[model samples]
Target: MPIFNQSIRRKIVGIALGLIVLMLVTSILSMVMSSQVGILLDELTNRYIPAYGHLARANIRSLERSVALRRMVMMKMQAPSEEEAYAARLREFEEADRKIDDEAEAARTLINAIIDDSRTPSDNAGLARIETRIETALTELRQAMNEDHAKLLKQVDDKQMTEVRGTLEHLDTLRDQFNQRIDTIRADMLKQVFASTRTVIGRQHQAIVISAIVTVLAAIVGFAFALLVSSGITRPVRLLLAGTREVEAGRFDKTITVSTQDEIGELAAAFNRMTEQLRHNERIRETFGRYIDPKVVQGLIDRPEVAIDGERRVMTIMFCDMSGFTSMSEGMTPRGLVRVMNHYFTVMSGPIRGNRGIIDKYIGDAIMSYWGPPFIEEDEQALLAGIAATEMVDQVPALQKQLPDLLGIRAMPAPCDLRIGIATGEVLTGSIGSELMMSFTVMGDAVNLASRLEAVNKVYGTRILISQATADAIGARLELREIDHLAVAGQSAPQPIFEVMARAGALTGAQDSLRAHYAEALAAYRARRFDEARAAFNAALEAVPGDGPSRTMLGRIAQFEAKPPEEGWDGAWRLEQK
Candidate 1:
C-alpha cells in the first residue's frame, strides 16, 4: 500500500536513478584500478628496462676494447719496425677505446635519469651510488689501457719485447676489473626490474579483488531494485489478463480490484464498468434472441437504422415446408410429433445458414428464409438461395433416416420430405410489428410468390420450384428443368417456373434426355398440339420413368384433350388452391 501511494512517474524515475548510480559506481571503481595498473606498467617499460639495456651495452663495449688492445699488441710484436702496420693497428685500438668511453657515458646518463625519476628518494640514492662506482671503474680501466697500449706500440717500434709483454699483462687485469664493475651495475638494475614487476603484480591482484567485491554488491542491489520495480508493473498486468479471460469466457460477474492510483488502476476501473454494462446488454440480447434471429438481432444492434425504417431492396426469399407432415404426425404422440419437427428443422436449417441465408421465421412445419444485403451481397443472393435449396433437397434422405429414431419408431407410414420454393425480386425488409413487439422480416410479392411456389411443388410432384426471376438470376449456375408457365392462385398473369435438378451440371446423362423430352412436350402443349405433346411427354417418361414434370404434363394434356379451352390460351394453367 505504501509503495502504491507513489505515482508511476516517481517510481519510474526512482528506478532509473538507482540503475544510473549503480553504473556510475562500477565505472569509477574501474577507472581508479586502471590508473594504478597503468602507472606500474609505465615505470617497468620506460625506466628500468632501458637502464638495464644501456648497462649491458657498456659491459660488451669494455670486452671489445680489451680484445682490440690485445690484437694491436700482437701486431706490433710480430712486425717490429714495420711502422705502417703498427700505425694501422694503433688506430683500431684508439677507435675501440673511444667506443668504450661512449658506451660507459651513455650508461651513466641513463642511470642518472632513472635515479631522478625514482619514486622513493632512498632508492634513488642507492642507484646513484652504483652509477658512480661504474663510472669510476670505467675511467680507471680506460686510462690504464690507453697508457699501456701506447707503451706497447713504442716498445715494438724500438724492438723491446720484454716491456711489450709486461704491459699486456697489466692491461688484461684492468679489463677484467672494468668488466666486474659493469656486471655489478647491470645486476642491480635487474634487481630493480624484478622488484618493480612483483609490486605491479601485487597491486593488480588487489585491484581485481576490490573490483570483484564492488561489482557483486552492485549486482545484488540492481537486481533487487529491478525485481521490485518490475513486479509492481507486472502484477496489475496479470490481473488485467485474468479479468480479460473471464470476460472472454462470457462470465462478466467478476470485477477487477484497483490496487493503485496509476493508469493501470484507472484502466481496471473502466474495465469493471464495461463488464457491468456488457452484463446488462447480454440479458437484453438473451431476451430478444428467443423472438429474433441472432444475426438479425446483432444487425439491428449494429445498424439501428435498419430497424428504424423500412427499405425496399431486391432479395431472394425461400420457403421450405415438410411434405406429408400432416399424414406423418397423425399417429405420432404429442411428444413424438414435437421431437420429429424439431429434428426436421434442425437438420434442414444447416444449409440455409451455411449459404448465408437468414431464417426469417418457422410456421408450423415450414421455415421462411431470405438472402440479401446486410447479410450477403445483393447480386449473389439468388445464386446462394438456389444453392441452399439444392443442399436442403440433398439433405432430405439423411433427415428421413434420422426422423424414425428421433420419434422412437422403426418406420413411419408416411415419410417426410422437403418442398422448397425460391423467388428473387424487390421486397420490403425491416422491423414490422407494433412498438410492443417489433420483428425484423421481409414482405412483398417475392415473399408471397416464394410461399405459393412451395405449395405448387406438390401440384407439380417436384421437390424444389423456383420462379422465373430467381431462375434467370441464378443463370447457368444450377441444373434446371423447365416445369411450366403457370398463373398460380392470386395472380392472373403467367410466370415461368422451373425445378432445380442439381447444383451444377449433374443432370447430363439420362436426366439430360429427360429434360430434352420434357421441353419438347411443354412446347408442343403450349402450341396446342395435343397429340405431339402427349407423345413427347410419354417419351420423356420413358427416359426418366419417375420424372415429375413429365407425369404432371401428361395428365394435363389428357384433361385438355377432354375439355379444350375456349380461345387465347397462352399455355398458362391457373391454380385454384395454394
Candidate 2:
C-alpha cells in the first residue's frame, strides 16, 4: 500500500504483469478443449448431418414420385390430343424416380464415411445399423414398387381407367412402406447426430466451466490487485469523479480532496480551483437569472451571436396586470407594498411558467410573457397562453384572500383582480438594447397589440381578451366569446377580438346558450341588420342579463339607430384612442 503511492507507472506495470499471466493460462486451456470439440463438430457436420439431410430428401422425393404418377394418370384420362401434358408428366415421374435412388445412395455413402472415420469416436454399431436399413429399404422399394409403378404407367397409357385407379392405390401402399422405413432410418441418424452433438456440448461445457472458474479467479485477482496497487491513485480519482459529477449536476460547492502528493493529487487540486470558478460563475447566473428568464440568460451565454441577430417568428404574447393594484398598494407601507407585490407576482407567475410561457419582464403590476419555441410548441403558443390566463384568473380568489393575510390585515383596502390580454402574430425576438445594456425581448405588432388588448379589457369590462390570431390558434380548446372586431389605436388592420370565458367544458348551461345567441347577434350586427341584431342581443341578454358583449352590442346598436353608420362601415369598431 505504501509503495502504491510511489509512481503511477510502477502500479500500472504490476497490474499488467498479473493480467498477462492469467490470460496466458486461460488461453492454453481454452485451445486444448476447443480442439477436442472441433473434432466432434467436424464429424457431425461432415458426415452425420449430410446423411440425415439425404434421408429426408429421399422421403420427399418418394411423395413427389407418387404425385407425378397420379398426374400422369389424370392426363391420360384427358382427351387423346393431350399428348404434350402427358409427356411432361412422364418426365417429372422419371425425375422423381431417379432422385429417390440418388438420395438413398447419397445417404448410404455418408453413413459409410462415418463408419470408416476414426478421427472422432462414434457408435459404430449405430452407424452400421443405419447403413443396413438404407440398403434394405431401397432394395424393397425398388423390387415391389418398381413393378407397381410400371403397371400404373402402362394402364394409364392404355386408357384403362379402372385398372389405373386400382394399380395407383396398390403403388401408394408400397410407397408408404418405403417412406416409413426411410423415416425409421432418419430417426436413427438423428439420434446419432444428437449423441455426437451432446459429446461436443459436453466438451464445450467443460471448457466454459473451467474457463469461467479461471476468469472469475482472474477477475478477483485483477480487481483486488488493482485496488491494492492503485489505492492511492484510484481513491483520489474516485473523489475527483464524484466532484465532477457534482459539478455536472450544477452543484459547485463540492471540492475533491487532495489526499496525496502525487500527480492525481495535483489534478484534484486543479479540479477544486475549477469548481470554485464555476461556483462563482453560477452565482452570477443566479443573480441575473432572477431578473431575466433562465432560457434568455442561457441563450445569451451559450449563443450570444445568434441571440443578438434577431429572427422573425410567430409568438403568443401576454400582458397581465393586477386590476386596482395601484389603489390597493397606496394605503400600505413600502415594505407591505413590496410584500404584496412579491406575493402577487409569485401567485401570478406560476400559471405562466407552469404552462411553459416565459416571463419577459415584470413592469410594475404587469407581467409580460410569451409562449413559443423553443420554450413551447409553436402552434400551441396561443392555446398555452389561453390556459395560463384561465389558470391565473382562477388564482384570483386565493390572491384576494391572501393579500390581506400577507399584509397582516383583515381585508385589503381595495379589491384586486387579474386582467390578461394575449395576441398571436409574427414578432422579432432576441436581445434588444444599446450595446451598453441589452434585454432579451420581442418587439413587433403582436407585442403592441397584446399591450393594447390589456388596456382594451378595461373598456369591455372583461377579464381576458385575445386577438383574432390568438383566438384562431386557441381554436375551441378554450371557451371564448366574440367580443368585437376592432383595429386598435396603432394598427389599421381590423382584427376580431374575443374574451376567454374558461376551459372548454367549464361553461354552464346558461353560458352555453348565451354564447350561441351572442354569435347570432354578432353576425346580425356585422350585417347591419340593426333591428335583428338588437332582438338577438336581447335574446342573448335573457340567458345572462349581465353579459358584457351583449350589452356592449346593444349600446352600439342604439348609436347606429340614431345615426346610420358611415357607408361601408365594415361593421368593425376602430379604436380612436389607446
Candidate 3:
C-alpha cells in the first residue's frame, strides 16, 4: 500500500520500533556511566552535602529541649505548697529531663554517624563545633537546675524562688546561643547542598540533550536507508499525489515529472495526462462566464458528484421580478434585450451578494435567490434578504435611465419597477436533477409561495410582499402592513401576508395611529369581543384611509359576529398557500 494510505496500526508500529531502539541504546549508556562515574558522584553528594546540615539541626533541637527541661525542673522545685502538688510537679520535671537526655543521646549518635560518613576534615570541623556548643550549654543548664533544686528542697521562700528563676534565665540564654550557632552552620550547609544539587541537575539535563541528539541522528539515518530501499516504488507515487492536489486547486499550468523508469513513474505520467483534460474543461468554464454568473457556474463545476434528490431544511427564499419588463422588452431587439437584461441583473446582483444571499438561478428578467444551506445564521437570513429586496426596489428608478432604448415609449409612461417576494420556511436546497447534469437549486412549497407572491405584487401594486412567518422572524426591524388574510389557491386556510414599506425610519402619525387601532382590534378579536374589535378597526380606517390590514380585520370581525365560532375557539388564522 502507498505510504499516504498506510493504516494507523502500521504507523504506530513504526513509531514504537523507533522509540524502543532509542530506549535500548540510552539504557546501555546509562548503565556504563553509573558503574564508572555515577556511583562516586552519588557518594560525594549524599555524604558531604546533607551530613553536616542534618547533624547541626539535630544538635540545635536537642540543646533546646534540654534547656526547656532544666527550666521545668527549677520551676517544679519551688512551685508546690501542697505535698501532692510537689510530688506531681517533681515527676513531670523528671520525665522532661529524661526526654531531654534521650534527645541529646540521639544527637550524639547522629553526629558520630556524620563523622563516619565524611572523608575530609572540613566537613567534620563545622559540625563538631556545633555539637561542642550544644553539649556545654546542656551541662551548664543541668548543673544550674541541680543546684536550684537542692536549695528549694530546704524550704519554699521568695529568696529561693528568685535564685531558681535567675538560674533558669541563664540556662535559656545559653540554649539560645547554642541554637544560633547551629542555625548558622545549617544555613551554610544548605547553601552547599543547593549548589551541588543544581550542578547535578545541570549535568543530567546536558546528558539528556546529548542523548536526544544521538537518537534523532540515528532515526534520520534509518529513515534515509528505508527511503533508499523503497524509492523505486514510493517517490513517483508521492509526486503523483501532490500533482493531483495542485490540479484539484486549478493550478494545471505546472506539470508533474518523475525521472524514474518504473510502474509508479508511468502512473505519475498518466495522472498528469488526466489533469490536462481538466485544464481544457477549466478553459471552457472561463468562456462560459460571459453567459451566466461565474459564481453559479463554478458552484456547479465544483460539486459534480452531489446527489440530486435530497432532504429539505428551513430557509429563506426571495424572488425579484422586473415590474415593467413586459412592455419594455417589446421594443428591444435580441441584442438590445440582452444588454438591458445584463444591466438589470448587474444592479440586482450587487445588493443580493452584499447581503450574502446566493443567486440560485436567473429566469429571463427575474431572479430566484435564497439564504442558508451554503450557510445559515439564526433569524438573520430573512432580515438580510428583506433589506436587500427593499434596496433593489429602491434602485429601480436609477437603473431605468440606463435602459432608455430598451424601454422605448413605455419608459415615459410608466418607469421600470421591481417587485420582490420573500418567504422563510422549509425548502430542499441542493444539487437537483440527473447525475449527468445537476444544478444547485431549492424546491418546496415555500419557493413556490415566494414566486406566487412576486406575481401577486402586480395585482396589489405593492413592491415587496412577505409572508407572516418572515415578518414574525424579522421582529421589530421594519413596519409591515398586513395586506390580506386570504387563502391562496391550493391552501386550505387563510394566511396573513404583509408588505414591508420602510425600515428604521420614523413612522408617520397616520401609520402610528393605524398600528395602535389595529393592535387594539386584534386584541379584542382574540378576546371574542367582535363588536369592540369592529369599533377599533373602524378607528384604524379613519386614521389611515384604505388601510389594507385594518380592512381585513374589520371583515373578519363582521364574519365572526354573523356566525359565532364553536366553543373553545382560539383566535388563530391559518394559511394555505404556496
Candidate 4:
C-alpha cells in the first residue's frame, strides 16, 4: 500500500526486477527436474541395455554348444577313424561350453553391479531377484551338462552306439530347459527396461507441467501486485478520463480530484485548471451569445482569424423588416412593443439559423443574416436563403396569432407582415468596426441591394423579393415571379428582381397560370406592345385577382401608353431614392 505512493519509475523498476527473478526461478527449477530425467536415461542406457545384451549373448552361446556337440558325434562316426577332426570337434565343443559360462558370468556381474548401485532406482530390486533365479538355473544347467558330456564321450570311445544316442537325447532335454529359463529371465529384464523408459518419459512430462504451473502462478502474482500498487495512480486517471468525456459533452464544470503525490496527481491538478479556464470561456460565450449568433460566437472563439482577417467572398445576404412594425409600435406602449419585437425576432431567427444562415445583427425591427463560406457552402447560400425567407413567411401567421396574447390586446391594430429581401453577390465579410468596438458583418453593394429590395417590397405589395443573382442561383427551387429589372438607388446597372411566391411545389394551379401570363405580359411590355401586354396582364389578373407583379406591370404599361419610352430604352426602371 505504501509502495503505491512511490513514483512511477520506482514502481516500473520493482515490477521488472520481480519478473526477472521469477524467470530465473522457473529456469532453475526446470533444470533441476531435467537433471533427474538425465540420470534415469543414463541408467536405462548403460545398465539395462548392457545387461540385456550380455543375457542375449549367453543364450547364443548355448545354441552354439548344441551345434558343436552334433559335429563332435559326426566326427567320431567318420571313416578311417578321423582322429584329427574328432580332436578339433572336441576342442570346439569345450570352447562353446566355456563361452556359455563366460557370457552368464558377465550378465550376473552386471546384475550384481546394478543391485549394489545406490544411484539405481529402488524399482530395480525386482531385477536382483530375477538375477538370483537366473544364477540358480545356470548353476544347475552347468552341472547336468558336464555329467552328460563325460558319459557321451566315454560311450563313443567304447563303440556303444545305442547308449551314446540315449545320452544325446537327454542332453537336448537339458539344453531346452536351460534355454527356456534364460528366455524367461530376458523377458523380465526387457520389461524392466521398458518400465524404466516409461518412468523417464513420465518424469519429463511432469517436470514440464510443474515449470509451466510455476510460471503461470508467478505471472498472476506479479499482475496482482502491480494492480494493487497502481490503484492510487489509476483512480485519478479514471477521474480524468471521465472529466474529459464530460467536457466533450459540453459540460465544463466537472473536475478531477488529485489522489496521489506523483505525476498523475499533477496531471489531475492541470486538468482542474483547464476545466476552470473552459468554464470562464463558457461564461463569456453565454454573455455574448445574446447580442450575436451562437454560431458566430463559437466561430470567433475557436478560430479568431476568420473574423479578424477579412476577405471578399460571394454570399447571400437577407434583410427582413416587419411591414407594420412602425404602426403597431405606435398603437402599443414601449413595454408591449419590446415584447412584440422580441417575440417576432425569436420566431424569425430559428429558420435562418436552422437553414445554416448566420444572423449578422438586428437593426431595430429588421434582422440581417448571411450564408457563405464558413457558415454554409457558396453554391448553397442562395437556395438556403430563399428557403429561410419562405419559412419566415410561413411563420408570420403564427406570429400574428401570438402577437395579441403577447401585447394583451384582442383586435389587431395593424396586420403584421414580413418583407424579406435576398441578394447574392461578392461582399467583404468579417469583423468590421472602429477601434472602440467591433461587429462581425458584411459590406459591399450586395448588402445595400438586399436592404433596397426589402424596401421595394412595399412598392410591389410583395412579401419577399430577391435579386437576379439570387434567383439565378436558386434556380427553380422556389416559386419565383419575375417582378422587374430595376436600378435601385445606389447601383446604376439594372438587375432583374424576382418575388418569392412560395415553396417549389406550394403554388396552386391559379398561381402557376398567373406566373405564365405575367411572364408573357412582361415580355410584351418590354417589346413596347402596350395593347398586347395589357391583354396578357388582364388575363393574369383573372387567374389570380390580387397578383402583385401583374398589377404593378399594368400600372407601368398605362404610364407607357401616356408617354412612350425612347427607342434606345432597355426596359429598366430606375429608383433614385435611398
lDDT of 4 by residue, 398-517 (tens): 888999998788967998899999999999978988999999888999999999999999888888999999999999888999988999998889989999888899999999998998
Select the stronger candidate by TM-score from 2 and 4. 4
Task: Mark the regions of model 3 whose C-alpha exceeds 4 Å error after superposition.
Answer: 1-252, 255-275, 284-306, 374-379, 405-413, 429-440, 477-479, 503-578
Worst 10 residues of 1 by lDDT: 114-123
What is the C-alpha lDDT profile of model 3 across 540-574, one tens digit per residue?
88998987666766777778878887897667554
Residues 107-182 of candidate 2 have per-residue lDDT tens digits of 8998898888887778999889889989998988889987887787778768788898788888888888888888
Q: What's the TM for model 3?
A: 0.46
Q: Each model's C-alpha lDDT?
A: 0.83, 0.88, 0.68, 0.88
Per-model TM-score, in order, reads 0.61, 0.61, 0.46, 0.65
lDDT of 1 by residue, 1-578 (tens): 56665667877888888989998999899888878777777767776677788778777766776677666666666733455665776677677777777876776776687667644222676678778877788777767766876787688667687877787777777777778878887888788778778878887898898888889989889889878876777788898899899999989987888887777878888998999999999898888665566789888878899888878999999999998889988998999888888878888888988988899999999999999988888879989999899889898888888888887778877967889999988999888888698778999999989999999998888999999999998889999888999887888898999999887878768888888988988899999998999999999889988887888888888898899977998888899888
Comparing 1 and 3 on TM-score, the stronger one: 1
Which candidate order results from sorting by TM-score in descending order?
Answer: 4, 2, 1, 3
* Model 2 misplacement above 4 A: 1-227, 251-254, 408-410
